[model samples]
Target: MLKRFFPDLYVDSIYHIPYETLKKNQIKGLVFDIDNTLVPFDVATGDQRLVTHFKELTRLGFQICLVSNNSEERVTIFNQDLQVEAIHKAQKPLRRSFKKAMKLLKTNPKTTAIIGDQVFTDVWGGNRIGMTTVLVRPVVDRDEWITKIKRGLEKKILKVYLKNSNNQ
Candidate 1:
């Protein structure tokens, strides 16, 4: 059903997430999709703003890992300064990488959360594994070709999800 793609939380940006609330909820680990979730697709590295944000999350006592379908070089270059655990070419919406990330964080699904910009990938994948899923609006309107195609379908689902949420 459409619920498979639905996120447990949706926000405008990662900066808008309530880390303290998540901590209180016992969510101790986070798996993040790097490209559009953290930076624009074209951006090659984490900006100072994002680095500081990760530091804050760590200080707040959360384990963090970056999971991306992008190439290893891409993930590596972006992760250089941040220096956290990372999984590249993640092939998300699949249980394997999500499980691997959980292993890396040493946390189970109940204590883990996944944050990303895509519904089919991040949300569906996280929900499948019983991890809290947080969907954030893409960092920029622009997207890679494949993502652009997926976004069209995502728009329809999001419209229905938003409508249903409001009616509640």
Candidate 2:
């Protein structure tokens, strides 16, 4: 159903997330999608800004994990400097990797949230597991071909979701 794709929160980008509010709500762990969620597809590493942001989150006592469908090489290269728990080739929208992430964070669904750009993969997967899902706008317009196809469908779903949300 369309409700499955509807994120608990939708914002412009990761930078727009209400981290303090999440903290206040007792969200102790965060699972993030890397490419196009935290950085553009072409970006190989987290920028200094992102690094600092991660540090801030850690200082606030939040456990973090990066989950990506991309190859291990890609995820490894990206996480080399950041050093947070990471899962590559995640095949998301499937519950397995998400469970694994929660295990690594030592957090349960009630205190964990997933942040990503894709509604089908990130939002739906997290929602299925009872984790708060935060959908952020893609970091860039360009996307891998398969994701490009999904994006078109996501737009339609978002239209209905937005209408329903506004009416509420």
Candidate 3:
């Protein structure tokens, strides 16, 4: 189905997300993809700005979790600042990790959102479980070769998605 790869919302960056609006919608938890979604792939920790934002989200009653397909060493180090529940080698676009993320936050699908920069992994997995999905632009272009290939496919899907949205 078209929803499988289509994000519920698109934004320039995670920093620009309207958390208040999400709260208004009764979204209680968020599962985020670490690399590119929160920061670039090479970054090891959340900067003060990002850490503060995460803290504010927590203050607003949103449980957050970091789910990544990267190694534990990478995800572990990157999560040191935010210090929320985290899972590594998530194997996203698969329902298992998404389910685990929901369990981590102790939230149901309707009240949880999955945020990431990739459609195939993040959006697809979220949609599969009927959870809201948010797509943000990648922080940088230096992705692994596998991801780079998926990005190519994502561009084509985006074109189709745009055409459909315009028609609607």
Candidate 4:
């Protein structure tokens, strides 16, 4: 479980991820977590940077979808602003939402990547479904109490993952 939570690629920030890398990896689609991953949880609208990134992703021929455990209201707000397909109340770590996103993208699991800030939810769920995962630092360090607890455990797993990656 812990191993699954650690992504194949870990970056300091999502902005650091290069589109060329995804092309090289043959990734044709992307599933992203909305809150904390794309923007701070408290933010109702996406930033200009994210909007530009979304446009560039489409320009590169990669389909994009947003998946969130947040409520419909929250997700809808983001969808309306970002103009992207989104799944609400995703219940991550379960494959249902991920599968739905794959269906919407019309892409195979082998050709998709999942990018998010959480280890337990985004990384574990994506890895479980055989998609490449990219873990990026959260936009905000402050999170819900439950998420904070999960993050604490995730830190332990991340340390080991970093060590193993170095050895590889």
| Number of colliding residue pairs in each model | 0, 0, 0, 0
For each candidate in turn, the TM-score is 0.98, 0.98, 0.95, 0.96
- Model 2, 1-168: lDDT tens digits are 689999999999888999999999989999999989999988899899999999999999999999999999999999987899999999999999999999999999999999999988999999999999999999999999999999988999999999999999
lDDT tens string, model 4, 1-168? 457677989988778887688889899988999889888888888878888889888898989999999999999988785788789999998999999999999987899999999998999999999999999999998797889889878889999999989999
In model 3, how large is the Cα lDDT of residue 143?
Answer: 90
Q: Judging by lDDT, tell me the better candidate of 1 and 3.
A: 1
Give model 2's clash tally.
0
Model 3, 1-168: lDDT tens digits are 665799888899998888889889989999999988898888788789999999989999999999899999999999887899999999998889888988989998999999999999999989999898999999898898889889888998988887887798
Q: Worst ten-residue run, lDDT, model 3?
A: 1-10
Of 1 and 4, which scores higher on lDDT?
Answer: 1
Q: Per-model C-alpha lDDT, please?
A: 0.94, 0.94, 0.90, 0.89
Residues 71-108 of candidate 1: C-alpha lDDT, one tens digit per residue: 99999999998999999989999999999999999999
Worst 10 residues of 1 by lDDT: 16-25
lDDT of 3 at 82: 82
Cα error, candidate 3, residue 63 (Å): 0.3
Candidate 2: C-alpha lDDT: 0.94
